[model samples]
Target: MSDVDSELMAGLARMLAAGQQRRAARAQTALETLRSYERRILREAAVMGYVLGYQSGNLDGRTGIGGPLDKNNRIPPDSEILRRVIEHCDSTDDLYPFLAAACDRRRRSITKARRWPGEAGAR
Candidate 1:
């Protein structure tokens, strides 16, 4: 092939590669966003479940229907975020706001714990 033809082909190939790379990066970002939402939903559900189960256990114990509930007081601290969400966003499946708040609460707690003084696990 002529030099000009070869260079043109190479330029086209480079453009195609750049476009493919851009598309792939965008797809990856979308996937990550979806996965982040998924993770938030699961975390909120689990934390809510923990709180509910603790409450249920307490009721059962009070009624003498079962043993004491959450004797170790394992009720999650993050439960408050879920409760607030329920109070404010009642009757909706939209947990985006709740997820943001709940994750932030957890992140703050984690950051605090990491800086805890006189603790073996402290940084």
Candidate 2:
């Protein structure tokens, strides 16, 4: 895995460990704190991919394989971004929690995309 992926995973493991020790209101605060790191990491990872690809001359005009990104590669999928999207999710109570969990799952998916083989052992 790349150094960026390792760093992000390390940050997430620490956040999760910290969350385990939190209680009551503190747990909510901790989760929000984690959410911020989650956003930062996702942004960094996406930027890393886009920058690497652009520098490698892989992206061309408006309609090639990956296509032209203009000023930005597609924005990374962020947990908070998903949470905002979930604000419009079906309001059926059970579905609300499921959507929230889906946001977390997306964050995890980004790491999995990195294919960090040692992440489980390291974390």
Candidate lDDT scores, in order, read 0.50, 0.46
lDDT of 2: 0.46
How does residue 82 of candidate 1 score in lDDT? 40
- Highest TM-score against the true fold, candidate: 1
Worst window of 10 by summed lDDT in candidate 2 = 84-93
TM-score of decoy 2: 0.26
Highest lDDT model number? 1
Q: List the residue pairs that clash in candidate 1.
A: none
For residue 95, give model 2's deviation from the true position in Å. 25
Error of 1 at 37 (Å): 7.0
Flag regions of model 1 displaced more than 4 Å. 35-123
Candidate 2 regions with alpha-carbon error over 4 angstroms: 1-34, 58-101, 104-123
Local accuracy of candidate 1 as per-residue lDDT tens digits, 1-123: 999999999999999999666544433333343346654675587576766765687776663433353345444466344444433332232433333333223222335444424454654
